[model samples]
Target chain A: MTKLTHRRLSPHILNRLIEGAPDESLALTDDHRRSLTARFRAVASNDHRRLDAWMVERAGLPYEPFRWSPASARRVVGNAALRRSLSEPTLTRGDAVALEVSDQLLRATSGYARPGSLASWLAQSSPSVVGLVSAEAANWATQLDEAAQELERPWSVAPSDAYYDVARARTTLRGRRDLIVPRGLTRVVLRVRAGAPGKSAGPGLRADLTIDALAEPTGLAASRVIGLWPEAGVVLSVDGTMEDLRAGARDLVRTAVAWQRHRLARAA
Target chain B: MTSLLDTTPVSVMDVLRGERDARPIANTTAASGLRAELEDGIFALLGPARRDAPLAIRASTLRSGTYAEDLTASLLAQVRGLLVTQALRLLSVGLEIDHAFDDALLAWRADVGSNELTRFVDQLESDERARLATDVTAHCVTLKRSLGPLSSRWLPRTSLRAYQRLAGGDVVLRDVIDLMVGTTTSDQASVALLDVTTSPLGEGAERVMRYHALVQTLRTSIVPLRTSMFSTAAGELWSANVDDELLSRAVGDVLETLRVMTVAP
Candidate 1:
């Protein structure tokens, strides 16, 4: 199964999360993808709905998409701004940078692409909504930038949250990776959590890495899946080995199965 | 009679940061020793840990009836606190927002989602909403003035939570700091904390602020530079610099609080 070689992540030392990451990468193989697809197809039902970690955890919840609020608005704005800051090495972190990133996002998505998304949300949002989004987003971005200070300069923000569809599996697996760093031939994937990481955080981190890998077009897998909960000043780093991939694959299959069972039971 | 504005112009940031001429020195204390004392006190109160029967004592629970047992008032307080919190998420970011009540109301409604509070608010009459609006407006005006400009350099993080388990996990002390500014990266003990309340800074305000400082100290193993409270009701600020004496007083307050609860009639 998946294992954490080093269990200790010192919160006492500031910016210890990215500074103490593992330096190993998993080589991509066609066999891995084929195995994952086969395993998913074996138990996959005709649910056809997107089965993300969130839906898998709370299958009973009938709806996932709710009306946009300050909380969700902040996430949308924060994710985009953080993505920009990480990608461009020279970009400094501040209000001016965040606002510039936000405006760039609005202009870039002015076309048919990302219509009815963050751009539209900001365009039509009231001054209060916009103001709150900007403020909250700035806080999250600043916190993340501070936490990743010691990390190497050439950091690449994951373009966007990704998803994978196994052919004939009839369901999709979604993963939202925040930042990615190149570790030689392999990569280091990171997810910045909003608050403190609790008991379920470990498994969630592995599952997220699995989903992101599955969604990635590149054949290469990450060296590790790093989880950062900045508020508590803590980091959880789990190694991405072959067993890690297998564990993530099995977890995704189990989620599909559980969702299938839950939906079927509800129908009955 | 002369108006207050004629005499002086004061901002919340000014008071919180201390005098314009003199910046308050960062104070440090033995966080481990103080935490041990608080944990030992809890152990004395509730001996022998029962893992199944763990107790969660909130900062509010330390106070008397105002924050206890009464469901309606507690629920009302929760709603009010959440609204102000949402408003701060805006104000703390340097948003030049107008109509504080309306802004916070929308924020509260949007952030709260569909819950009992949402239903309760939805069921309120026009006149009730008007009254809430008036009260919230007054509070937001004061809060907006006092919170001042947060920006990014201060590294403002809001709604930060701390959970400290004592007595072998039998007693849990939980607290949420409304806004935490400054940085812990430096060695000068440069962390400053603020607890915001929509209610007046009444008798229990200091107790709440102390509990927050205590939990933060135990959780981070770093003493805060300053711990303060601001009341939207009175537009007033109260502060206690972090030092040995303040922490010692906080530890005693917590122990006495637990004793009263353990020996309840």
Candidate 2:
């Protein structure tokens, strides 16, 4: 048998070699796209189901319900006002926008304690989390108020925070949908960013879109995903094709695997 | 306009609310002409820079100013929030919303990601944090005292960002307004723009205000009612009725700067 020699090139060298290559030459065929999507869907469904079963039935890992803040300090706050705008009548003034979010936040967090004393409760829950929700809420209110001046009203429906449970499992997924708008005969998931526009779909956002797509209610899946950067006044849209769904599924599986490993590692 | 630097802190709210007199922009044709001429020259100079680096004049680049400006601008947002939302507490069980700077600071920190200001705060020790908070508190107090309790009627710290394509889309002119009041109209000037700064009133102050007013005029085609400068550090306020003179001078100054920056050897 002839000995085989394999060369491992540095990533920098590999990237340099591929730099400025014709995109058409590197494009995937339709069959390749379909096959990749099918493989990803199988991994999410079949492989995920098998592993989850083993963790529960064989290893006897205790079920922990996933809990997520409806208004995390990160990206969620920017969406608060957009979500509110979709549900309420058009708000033309910043003050009105601020008032709207303040009411919604009060109602949303009413379950925690009372409306005005949320900081104390948040402090009790976690001191680091204080004022995070409020700041984001305020920023979103101001942003949407400005945006409303430019955007035409109508065409959006059923904007809300969503919670989904995996099929026959204790695991839960929480996500924010700024708006669900009809695209031709199908629906599209919309997210609005406050600052400059971004075209690249990062892994985290792709996972988020994937999870939201999978959690569609009653045979309805988002046919497209849109990200609107209002400051830059740019809209980025991606078709909800199988290829996109598979990309999302792939990210979701990677996340699930990492989460399981973290849980098991902590347990041991 | 008479100087009001007397026993009382000057009230910018009245000007923002359009209680003060405003003169129509003088020589609108001349001012507009100068602006166009200078902008074309600037784009011509910036063309080489664009070829070298396409993104040298983006929105973020437009905001690249002194560190003090960025920090003070952020701090002003918090102060504005407190003033506007003083009446209704989002999660307040009590009638009064919490006025602690510490809470507001924490919230601002949470929402802002890793930026220059955040990195600065991250490296600060407790003493440094306290010192920075104290200085911010002083500025806020002075701003509140100067502006008086802003009626929930007015919007505070309103942000404006727009891009005007110039040089046949080869060059983009980015405009940013710090805070604005009054509803803008297309046919006429209705809005009042207030430029907030941490630095004391300086030579560049009036020029900056003119630039801001000019940008708004271009954006809306209606002259801004008035342009004002509010310095939180010195507790001073200056207002000028937007006219063709200030706008023309601003255009000249911008053209000079561009000529020096890009065209000069």
Candidate 3:
């Protein structure tokens, strides 16, 4: 009798499992990480299609390119606020941090050469519309400030958003780390979300950590990933491992598939 | 207080737009008297209640806290934010299509907190969530239909909040303007304020616009040119040129509200 190998679960499939079992905590053991990594590698090798090709061809998705600044503002704002607060040791109150973050965002707008430069956009546009953008920025900064207050450790490296590009896959990933404080040999990646952890939050954090992990060179992985929902005064922590990357890759595939299905439905 | 000059009053929008037609307010005496009356009424309540603590009031609290009223306000604000952001993107970079209602909503939820609206939905059972989602979807459609065309021309500065103290900081009045357009000046009205509401047009809605104008007037010596209120539910707009009379009327209403609040409490 011929030996049979079971089909490896895709990121989407794993995500469904994660979503179904919300009560199950995601504490991946080292052995589990290795097994997951092997499964991820096997799946990637067997699947000859590149991400870009799958997105464009299989999904039939038109490349609706978006500016990075607005989509990634939540992550960027938190990190920037923390960096500014840390720079000025006297600044303690979240409100003060909130104001600083607001200023940073407003200042950064001047350098925005992107198609949707908020400053330039507001300058020509009606003054009333500027309020929406400013209010949005203010709210985000406030939340970040609250998150910053909750974070006890002093950050060694200044917080910033990062971009990772893989030439072979033609994939670009953006990672926003609220604070990156080094503890011994491992760097902790903290993410500040607005409210309490929802159903998708666990997988979402894993996906975020995966991007951060892949963005770094091999062997220098993030030791821990912490998701902070400041409004709820809650902290969710997960180990950063190769399993996260595998899960993230599966999520990417799932996202493409969902996009394809949506496109096809619309076309029909 | 500056005395009224015997001159023709300009429309508030024109002053805000910085048009040459901008002029001083028409009836400063009546306006001042009305304001004084309101202040007296407020002090009547505040003076006896608690001398040690300053009264704190939010502009939102002035309105009825009915579910419908709260829901409408929140919905209008959300729609305004969504439209403004889309308009910014369209004007600056130009997208092939602005985000659909669902996409815009997702973006809105991301930017805003898990607010009352989210909480309202979350507390509901599965069946209730389905029904509420359907109702909300329909409401969203109506709002989009009303707001889509208006979004491009608005070019507003949204969520402008201000506080004013009367009677030596014992009485504090707060107001938040949903949207402000054009420029503001000390000598001439140079800005137009737009207050968006989800509720149908009513006296309360009008008073809210007046409160916003009053706040702006206190902040900038020159009264704003036009104060307009838009109702998303009815898709109707009512705009009045800002004069001392309008600001004074708003002051009176606020005072009356305070009188009721402080005394009733």
Strongest candidate by DockQ: 1
Candidate 3 residues B1-265, lDDT tens each? 9988797544323333444565454222342454476568776666645457666555555555222343355543444444434333222211222333334344444444467655654576888645544544444454444433322122334455555556756777666666565443223444677665555778667777787777666543346678887665566777887776787777777776666655652
lDDT of 1 by residue, A126-184 (tens): 66666666666666666655545546435766777768887776767777677777766
* Candidate numbers sorted by DockQ from highest down: 1, 2, 3
Error of 2 at A175 (Å): 8.0
My TM-score estimates for the predictions, one after another, are: 0.84, 0.56, 0.41
User: DockQ for all models, in order?
Assistant: 0.39, 0.08, 0.03
Please give the range of 10 consecutive residues that has the lowest summed lDDT in model 1 chain A.
A6-15
Runs with alpha carbons beyond 4 Å of true place in candidate 3: A1-268, B1-39, B48-54, B59-62, B65-104, B115-117, B125-155
lDDT of 3 at B184: 33
User: Tens digit of lDDT per residue, candidate 2, span A1-268?
Assistant: 1111111111122122122112221122445434434543443332333222113212324355433331443244445444555456464333343454355446546564453343233434322233335434444554444433433323442345455455433344444456564544455555555444322334334444545654554423465555544444444444455555556545444545555666667769
Off by over 4 Å in 1: A4-24, A55-63, A83-116, A150-156, A195-198, A215-218, A231-234, B3-7, B19-39, B51-53, B63-78, B147-152, B163-170, B218-221, B263-265
Q: Score candidate 3 by TM-score against the native.
A: 0.41
Please write out the lDDT profile of model 3 over residues A1-38, one tens digit for every residue.
11111111111221222222223223334553455344
lDDT of 1 by residue, B1-265 (tens): 9755655466666555664344344333466688688777877777765658766677677544233352345555666677777778767766666777678767666556689987876787899878777777777777886666655666676777676666756777778888887765454556778888887877778888788878777766567778888888888888887777778988887788767666765
Top TM-score model? 1
